[model samples]
Structures are given as C-alpha cells and as structure tokens.
Target: DIQKKKQGTFLPKEARIQPAAFSMAQVAKKPLPKAPAVSIQEEEEEEFKISTGMEPGKTYTGQKLDLDLQDIDLDNVFRLIAEVSNLNIIVSEKVKGKVTMRLKEVPWDQALDLILSTHKLGMIQQGNVVRIAPLKDLLDEEKERKRVKQERLQAKIEAAKRLQEAEIEAQERERKLRPFVTEFITLNYTKAKDFQAQIKDILTKEPKLERVGTAVVDERTNTVTITDYPEKIERIKQYKEKVDKPTPQVLIEARIVKATKNFARELGVQWGAQYAEYDKRGEWAWGVSSATGSGTTPPVTPSSWQSGSFTQGTGRDFFPLSGWMVNLPATLLPTPPGIGLQVGRLVGDLINLDLRLSAAEREGLTKIISRPKVMTLDNVEATIKQGREIPFTQVNPEGNVSVVYKEASLKTTVTPQISPDGRVRLKLDVTDDFPDRSNANPITGNPEIVKRQGTTEVLVRDGETVVIGGVLEETRATAEDGVPWLKDLPGLNWFFERKTRRHDQTELLIFVTPFIVQQD
Candidate 1:
C-alpha cells in the first residue's frame, strides 16, 4: 500500500517549472520619424477639409486660402471659410440653397465678400463675431437708420423755432397786459360756478398774459371779478359774450309701429303706444303685435309682421323672432340635432297635437309610433345653413360613409347697413333642407334631402317692414286602414288594405325691419 501511494504522489518537472528573469537584450525600441513642415495655408486647408466647418464659438487666425469648390454644398463652403478665417460666422434661418465658387489665394475678408455677393447676402461684423443675412434686410435697415437721423435733425430745428416764438410771444403779451395787471375787472355771467373753473383755466394756461390772483364770483348777482393782464381781460370778455348766448332746445319724437300694418294708428292700438320720457334728451315707445297663429301657420295663412319703432337720431336696434311658422306634417318635421320643436296641428285633421319637443324627444316619440322597418315622418329632417357647411357620417350595411351636411338649418343671416340718408340696407340669407319621401323606399334607408336657399339685398327706411316670401313646401302622409295579415292577402289586398292619403302644402315667410333709437 505504501509503494502504490508513493508512485501516485510523484511530481513532474514541467509542472514545477519557474519563470526566467527579465533582460534588456530581449526587448528592442524603435525611433519615431519626424513630420514634414507644412505651410499655414496648407494646414488650414487640410483642417477645413477634415472638420467640414468651424464651430460657432471657436476662433481661428485670419489666414489666406485657395478654394475651388464646384457643385459643393453651400453649408460646407460657409463652414470651410469660417474655419480658414477663424471667425464665428452664423448663417441666418433666411439663408437657403447652395453656392459654387472658384477663387485663387484670397484673403479671408475678400473671400467672404465674394461669397456673400454671389448669394445676395450681407455680413454684419461686431467685434470678432459675424452674421450673414439677406441683402434686402440690410438695405432696409440702412434706410430706416437714415430716416431716423433725418427726423432727429428736423425735430431739433422745430424745437428751437418753437422756443424762439414762445419767448417773443411772452414779451409782446407782457407789454399789452402791464396796464390791466393792477386794475380790477368785473363781469356779469349766468351759471357763475360753471364758468369760474373755465375762466381760471384760461388765465392759468396763457403764458404771455401774466395774470395774477384767482377768479372771484358772486352767485347772487351772477357776476365774476378778476385782476389780470389786459389781453386776458379782453379774452374773458369774449368768453362771456359767447356764454351769454341762449342754448337751443332739441326735441326727439319716437314712434312705435306695428310694422305689419302701414298705418301709425294700428301701432297705437296694438301696443298702446305712448311717448315715455327718457331722461331730458328724448322719449322711447314700444308695442306688441297681435298673434295670428298658435306658433304654427296654416297651410295658407296670412303672414305675420315684425315690430319696430323709429326716432329722429342715429341709433342701433335689434328685432328678434321666437320662431317662424311652417305647415309641414308632424311626421315630416325636420327635427335635426340641436333644434327645438313646437308641435302644433299634427299631419291632417286626424291628429291635432300642439306640443313642443327638442330634437331628441321627437326622435324618441317616432320610435314608439313608427315600425322599425318603415320610415316615419321623423326619419326626415329639415336642415338650415347660412354661408357655412356642416358634415355628417351615414352608416350603411357595407361601411360608414361621410357626407357633407346639405340640410338647411332653417336659419337666416341678417346684416343691416345704414346709409347717409337714414336708409337701412339689409342682407338676408335663408336656407332650408327637407326630406324627399318620394325617393324613400322600404329597402333603402332614406332618400336625399331637398335643399332650399334664398338670399336678398334690399334697402328700406327705418320702421319700414320687408317681407320675403315665395317659398313653398309639399309633404304627404299615408296611413294603413286594414288588418296586417288581411292587407297582405293576394286576391283581396285592395279591399282588405286601404291607405288613407293626405297631401299638405306649406309656405315660409320672413319679415325684417329696422328701427332707430335715441342715443343718450
């Protein structure tokens, strides 16, 4: 066992080997070669090529350079030149495009000039910094600078002339006012308190008058006394004469007109028109018109009139209407989004409902009354547009499609302009969109909307009414009068299914008027 253990523990010579000691003879060093001398020009050119351009803040020595760049980027040229000149050159945002130049050993300044000239650019130098901008901008700046200089010179000359004139005026005023300065003067004037401040202001502002003492007034006799230069005294006398003149009275009469009727008597009867005092200036009168329709017009009802008033002065007035009358069917009401509905006399004599609902409420009511597959009157919407377009999206079985809003909003645009002769010029634009049920089929969703637009420019006098009419709309309503299954029978369909047909014709009328109110 011992002999086997000793053989197993034997060490190899290579495994126990040590590293050899260091020797200078084993390592050899080589000498570095000297670089060739380069000219300043050549060194700069080499640096320009390597660096492409100069940094904005870095400075360089002014050195001559020979560059012959063709079809090279202008930005690269600016950078190379910047590096050679050792200048902080900044290119403005206005500078664009490339530049090509061919030059022989040129000074930095000369090269910069040539480049700027070729590009229609100008350079501004401040200390060691340089900025390049459009040539026109620099020229404009120069013109403005010259203009300012000329103005300054002219202002100085004017100021000197004014000072001389003031001095001369003072001497003349002193000579003329010396005699009256010691004399006491009294004048009779009404409203002495109102004139006292004015008289003192006139005396104080007159530099040449040489006035002394403030004005003294006696309210009992309406007399004012003052001691001042003779010129100031004469001026006060002239002022007193002017103030003593009688003030003219002005009376303003305001007339309220029903505007619907041509006679002024009708206005008095409708609104109990009477002159109501407004301060001391004038009077204002207002009246109301009789109601012809219960918010909805008959298919052929007479047009209602607008209310207005007139005064003998220039003023602005507003004529607002709650809503217009339309004879369209209840089912065909154009209850588009953001619209208000006032239900009155439903389609035909069968339904006589007078209710007002918003667009959303009308839609809900339609769902309860109409079949899901059938298109009801609510399916049709009336739209109005005035010099503007509204867009909407329509979804079909295939996909969602975008469509421009062609429906008239039933709204009108009214602009009033006044002329020198007291005549009012009005510009009116009215637009309406109604559904065309004739093209609507059970298969298709709905037919396209019928569009109506009207515009007119008219001239009228204040309190005169302008009525715009000739707009006609027709709508149809059909109701089934038989049982569901029996109406669909093949042989007896006509007898079992009877459709009650009704046709409605409606018209829209617009009334506009201008009134003049007295200004305070």
Candidate 2:
C-alpha cells in the first residue's frame, strides 16, 4: 500500500506543475548573440575622413578624387566632390540626368568635369563657391545675346543711310531750282515805261513770288526778269490776261415764319325762364327780359293802354293793379345778366343761351391769343460759301456694295444761280429712301427700297424773308379738379370729376433769309 501511495503522490497536481516550471526555466536560459569585434560605423567614419581629408570649420583645398559610380544621380556626384574638396558647390535645378563615370587618382576638378560633362553640365567658379548649370542653356543664352547686339548695330546703320539720303535729296532740289531765278523774258508793250512799273508793283504784292525771290524789271529793254519758283513764273506769264477780266458778284437773302392759337369751351345745364312780346309794328321785341319787382312793370310785357306796343314808364308812372296780378317772391327769383341773354326767339321755360363773341373784341382778349415772341435765326452759320466747294462721302449699306454708277443708292445735287442784280436761285434735288410696301415679299417679310426724288426751286433777293406752312389742329383732353380715389370709382365717380378738353391749332412757319458776304 505504501508503494501504491508513493505512485499516487507522483500523479498529484504539484508533480505536474513542477515539470512545467522546469521546462520554462530551461527555455529562459538561452544565450544572447555575441558582440562584434570592431564597430563597422566607426570604421566607415574613419574611412570617410581619410578619403575626404577635410575638417569642419576650416577652409578647403581641393584633394584627389577616385570614384567609380554607375547610373547615379548628377547631384549625388556633386555632393561627393563637395565633401572630398571641402568646397561649397551648389547644384542648380537645371543640372539633371544620371551619370556613369570611372576615374582614378585624378584631381577633384578633373574628376568633377568627367562626371558633369557626361550629363552636359558646367560649373561657374565664384570665389569659394561653384554653381552648376546646363551647358546647352549657357550656349543658347550666349547665342541670343550676340543676335540682339547684331540687330541693334543693323538698325543704326539703316538710320544713318536714311539721313544721308534725305540730305542728298535737298541738295539736288536746290541745284535744279537755281537756274530759273536768273532767267529773263522780253515783252513788247504798246504802253509807255509806266507799264513796267505796274508789273513790278504787282509782283511785289504777291507773297508766292517774294518767298523764293523777287522780280527785276528794266524800263529801257521793256524786259521783265522774275526770280521765283517755277509755279509762280507761270502765274506771272498770265498776269496780263487776268487783269483784263472782270469779277462778278451777287447778293442773296432767305427768310423763316411761325403761328399758334388756343380755344376753350365750358359745357353745363341750367333751368331758367324768360318772356318776350310783339310790338306795335308787328315785330317781336329783340330779346327776353326779366321781371323787376312789385311796384315796377314787367319789362318783357306790353302796357295796357298801348295795346300791342311795349313801353317803359310811358304815361303810366304808377304800377296798375293788373301788373300786380301775378306776384313773384323777390328773394326767391333770380335774374340773368344782359351779357347772358339769348339772341333768338325764346319759347320754352328753359331757354338755351347761345353766346357769340366776335374777333373785334376790345378788352380781355390777351388770354385767348398767345403772346408774341421775337426769334432771330442767327444761330446756324452758312456751310455753302461763295468760293469753296465741300465734298461729302456717303456710308455704304449693310449688305450692298455700290460699284456701278447706275446701281447707286441715292444721288443729291445742288446748283446755285446768282445774278448781278442781287437775285439768287437755289436749285435742290433730294433723293430720299422709301420702303416699297406695295411689293413686299410674302415669305421673307422684307420690303425693297425705293428712291423718291423731289426738286425745290426758289428765287429771292438779298435780306428778304419767305414763309411756308399753315395752321395745324390738335386736341387734348384731361380729367381735372377731382379726387384721385373718387375719380377711379366704378359708376358714381362722374359727379366727383370734371374733364377739361382743349382744342388747339398750331401753325409753324419757317422763314429763311440769305445774306451776301463780302470777301477781301
């Protein structure tokens, strides 16, 4: 049993946990990796120092370079050279492309040249620093600078040539014109030597002859020698003919006239009464008259004694009892004025009074007639002058070219005829463009252009006025004297509004006057 108990103790939890702990300690007892004999980074740093031969914070002299780099960047090779020589070398962005070079025991500059030349790069040595640039870019920049210099030199040469040509032209002109000044012309005149003095005096007054030179006339030979330009010499030859001709002058006048008129009317309805009687001559009294008062006889009725005659206080000083038969209240009855009396026969209780005022009114007529205004037509200056002819060019149409004379759009011509008696006639022909609506195209809705031509001819003397046009009629109506909100009411607004209608006749008269201008 004891032997069984010993085997049981070996099968318990402690025996199982002890074997796991022993295996974990055996795994934890493993040995770490061995340390290196010599430091690789230190060896590399030492080799780098030997290869570069450079110290920090010290000026650098170039050292020998031995490099064997393949398919490396150009900037990387430049960095290697900068370390070896301890020199400040900057690479520009333009220094690009890969490099593959092999060199042995060469100077740093020579070694740098081999690496950079393969990639077409060049360095600029500026004091202690070097700058890298592409060789192609430098060559192109130099070529462009030379081209610009050549262009400037060529421009200067052309300017000098132009100046020399102008000087030669002036000298040639002076040489050709020198001979004409000394030439003389002989003239045979029937008049005395006084005629030679007259010719000399005329040439002196002429500015063109005096500008180039002057004239010398000899009375003994009766010969004239004029020192002037060739064009002036031609005018001198024709001086005798021009003096014999007479100059003509004329005077012209033009006048411009305008009229305006106003008319007003009042429309209303009134209820009133009037009476009239027949006279002794069987003729009716002229107009209706109003009844005065109780003691007075009615002015419109005939008297009792005269039978048919109407009398005003004739032998009847006192009012008869018959005159007081129909009494009317003095305060309630209204009397119409004499100016408001109707002219025709009156019959109804409400008589329509037709008022008429003649044009021979003597008072208060200024309101009906417009005030007169004085206007002067001196603002526009005359464009057509006595001796000047002005030419005007017309603009071309949108889609047409006027190459042929017959196919031209319009032609206007003006001709002025002047007489010696101060009578002037203006002949004007105006061709206007009009749309041809009668022959409009049905599909395109386009109308052809038609030319309507008219001619105007008028004759007038100097300082005379001419008038054209008559009265024109126009009507204007406006709703005035009413409240805005009440006038717009649907049906009951007519009482709140009063409309004013004006009939106007306006006459615009154009007065044109022409005056003669004297020239010196």
Candidate 3:
C-alpha cells in the first residue's frame, strides 16, 4: 500500500544487484569477531606460509612481473614484489631509501634483489618470509653467528685436549707400576759388550726411561741381557736385530810384480807365442841357455832346460871360428839370444842388442816377486810379507852390545770396505825393504836398508782388478876388460880393451782383486 505508485527504472540489467549481494548482506549482519592478539613471531609465522611443492632452503623462482616504477620507496617496492610473488616480506625500520627502476618481465625475487642492492639494503629469507634490512646490520648479525660457532669449536678442542692429557697420565702411572721384563739376545758377529755400550748411550738420551732400562753383557756366551718395559724391550730387540748380523768377509788377491816399462805388452806377446806352440804340439816347452867366457875361448853349448816333455837332439855346430857363437838345439830356438851372451864378445855386441827382450830375460828384467792372497773381515787390515828379518848389533848407553832384528821385506797392507752395491773401497800401504849391498857399514859390514813405500786409496767393483804402480828403480854400471898392459895404453885402448856401459830400470806394479765372500 505504501508503494502503490511504482517508480519506473532505467538501470541496465548488468548494473542491477546480483544474487551474491544477499549473501554479502547476511555476512555483514554478523558481529565482527575480535582478531586474537598475536605476537610478532606469531604474526610473522602467520604471514609466511610455506610454498607448495617447495623444500625449505631451496632457491626461490618466483613469478615474473613487468613493472615501470619511478622513484618508489624501497619498502613499497619490496611489498609490491612480495604481493606479486605471494611471498611474506618484512621491511626493517632502517630501510628508508627510494629506488627508480624499469623492469620488464623480470622474476619477482630478482627485482626485489635489484631494489635492495641499489639502496645498500640486504635480505634474509627463511622459508617464504623475506626480511629487509640495511647491509651493515646484516653483516653484524653474520659476524656474531660466526663468533659463536668459533667459540663452540674452541671449547670442544679444549675438552678433547684435557681428556687426552688425562689418558696419557693414566698410562704413564700404569707403566711405572708394571714390572720390568728381561730378554736375552745372542750376537753372531758383533761384540755383546760393544752393543751394550751403545744401548747405554741411547738410554742416557731418554730422560723418562734412562733409569728403567738396563743392558748387561755376558762375554762367555756373547749374549746381551736387556731389562726394560715391554714396549722399550721390543724396540731394543728390533735395534739389536738390525746390528747383530754376520760381518762380511773380503778375499783380497794381490800380485806384486817388479817389471820394466814394456813388460806388460811383451808378456802378452810371449803368452801368445806359447799358446801358438801349445796348439801345434798339444804342449808347450820353454828352455833357457847361458854361455860364459873369460877370454877368446870357444863357446860351449849348454844343456837345454826343458819345461815340457820333448825328444832330445844332438846339437850341430853352427859357427866354425867365432868364439861367441854356439849351436843351440832347434827345439830351444825360441829362447832369447840375449840370455846367452858371451862375456868375451859381450862389449862388442852390446851396442847391437835390442832393448825390447822376451820373457826369457825375466831373470835380469821383469820378475813376479810374490802373489799374496788373504781373506779378512770387511774394514779390517790384512798384511802379507815375503822377505826375511835382518839382525843388527846395537850398542846401548851401558856399552853392552845386543842384537836387534829389523824387518827387510816386501810387505802389503790393505783395509777394504764392502759396499752394498758390490763395490770395494781399499786403503793400501805397501813397503819394499832390501839391503843396499853397494853401501855397507865400515866396521859391521852390514848393508844399509833401502825402503820403498807406497800408500793410496782406491774404489773398485767386486772381482775387478786394479793396478797400482809408480815405484821405480834405476842403475848404471861401467866395466872395462882387456889385456892388462894393452888396455893401459890410452891411444890403443879402443882396439885392445872393451868398455861397456849399462843402464837398467825397473818398476813395482801391484795388481789387486777383491772378492766378496758369500755366506754359506
């Protein structure tokens, strides 16, 4: 009745109220309930919901946004980005700068980062909540966290150190309470007393164990008794094992040859000739002959001294009138002619003799004095002697005469060191002593002692030979023989008398070879 007059409406259907308006009106009629009071932490948790299908601590790939902004507040920009990305953002009070940027289709997270960087601001994200603050405040918080972590680590280290010290103290106390153990070790080559001395020296250096360790030597059994803690005893046993093995032995073979300068080469040739003769007859024979004459007497052929079996033959006359010539058997033809020189024609033919002679002339030229082979322990000196001792009368201050013996001999002394690589280092001392018959004492008629000595050190491989030389001796002599009255005439001396000058030289050569003896 009150609305009897109906007003005409010109509103379009699209602009009229929809069915949702009734529900909205009903919702407004309900009393607005009071929101529960929330703490800052609760509010933050409520604002930030974990993103769906994303793990915590994962990099956020937020929604892309295209924004054209001009001098916008940094906090507003962060809020805008948070809204676009559906992320919870908290802006610090210290964040008050404005940013001007035009970003097209950039990730929301990246755009937020750009705004924060330009303003010297920083962010800390926990799950979906992002905190915005000044960079200085964030740096201070990070430093504080590191300082706390370092303090915790240092505390753990100190606790561990204290625990270790306590354990070491317990072990030391237990060791002191333990009884000493004794062990006996027998030595094969090394002296027990020597090793005991070494062990004593080692113990003296250890302040904690010096009083506890003892080493005693029993010479009768060549045994060393060690008394110490079990651990120290084991260490001593190991050390003894390293040093108590057998000492190596060295077999030194030495050849002492007194020869001329050309002896080595001439000896080689002589050996070759002997080998050739041996090949022809299956055996070789060497013969030597000598002839001596006072005046012009016809030379007599000496008997051939044979070294091997051969048929003897009657000699034929080769020279008719020359007293210097003699018929030699054909089998002894290889003997050097210089060995059979006649004393009558020796001065006349001496000028025509060859300086290089064969091995048959060894009696006057080259001689093998001695070949001494000795076996000795490594680093021990070995000596060899080949001559006699001479006696001399010594008158003391009391006017009593006594005989004193002096060694006049050829002696060789060598000390050899064996290396692990099968090499030998040798220290050599050689002495050659002889009587000088040409110079004799006036009253005693005793010859003066002539000594030649050589000393050297050399390194050579096992079983290898080394030669040592340089001791040389030289002699010169002159002789004249002829008819006495005719030789006295100065003008006719050349025709009647024969004068000869001879020069001789010899050297001492030592050939040494060392062999390492293998243990059986």
Which candidate's TM-score is highest? 3
State which candidate, 1 or 2, has the greater TM-score.
1
Which regions of candidate 1 fall more than 4 Å away from where they truly are? 1-407, 435-450, 484-496
RMSD of candidate 1 to the truth, in angstroms, is: 35.4
Structure candidate 3, residue pairs in collision: none
Model 2 misplaced regions, further than 4 Å? 1-178, 182-257, 261-416, 428-455, 470-481, 518-520
State the lDDT at 298 in candidate 1.
25
What's the distance in Å from true for residue 496, model 1? 4.3
Candidate 2 lDDT over 1-520, as tens digits, reads 1122231221112111112112323322333223334465553333211111222453423455455656666776665556445567777787768766666556776666655555666665534456677766655655765686678689989999999899987766665555545556666532324434555644434243334346666767766677765656677677744443323333322211123322111111111112223233442232222343223233321111111223432331112322112211112112210111111111111112112112212333212221122222222222221111222223365754333222313223334455455544444343334344456667444454544343434444554332222212234556477888997798978978887877654322222334544435
Ranking by lDDT: 3, 1, 2
- Per-residue CA lDDT of candidate 3, range 1-520, in tens? 0112123212222221112113223322343233334476664334332222223464647656666666556665664555455567777898786666666666666666666666777776665566777878877877766686689789999999999999987887776677778888888888998988877744423347334577888999999888776777778778888988888999998766777755543432111111001112323222212232122223222221212222334132111333323321111212211111111111112112223232425456667677789999999999977788888877788988888788898777889998666778777776767877677888676778876555545555677655554445567899989988988887887788988999887755566778899998
How close is every model to the real structure, measured as TM-score? Answer: 0.25, 0.23, 0.52
Candidate 1 per-residue C-alpha lDDT over 223-278 given as tens digits, one digit per residue, 9 for 90 to 100: 67766666777788788887754332111111111111211111111112111111
What's the lDDT for all of these models? 0.45, 0.40, 0.58
- Top model number, lDDT: 3
Query: Worst ten-residue run, lDDT, model 2?
Result: 337-346
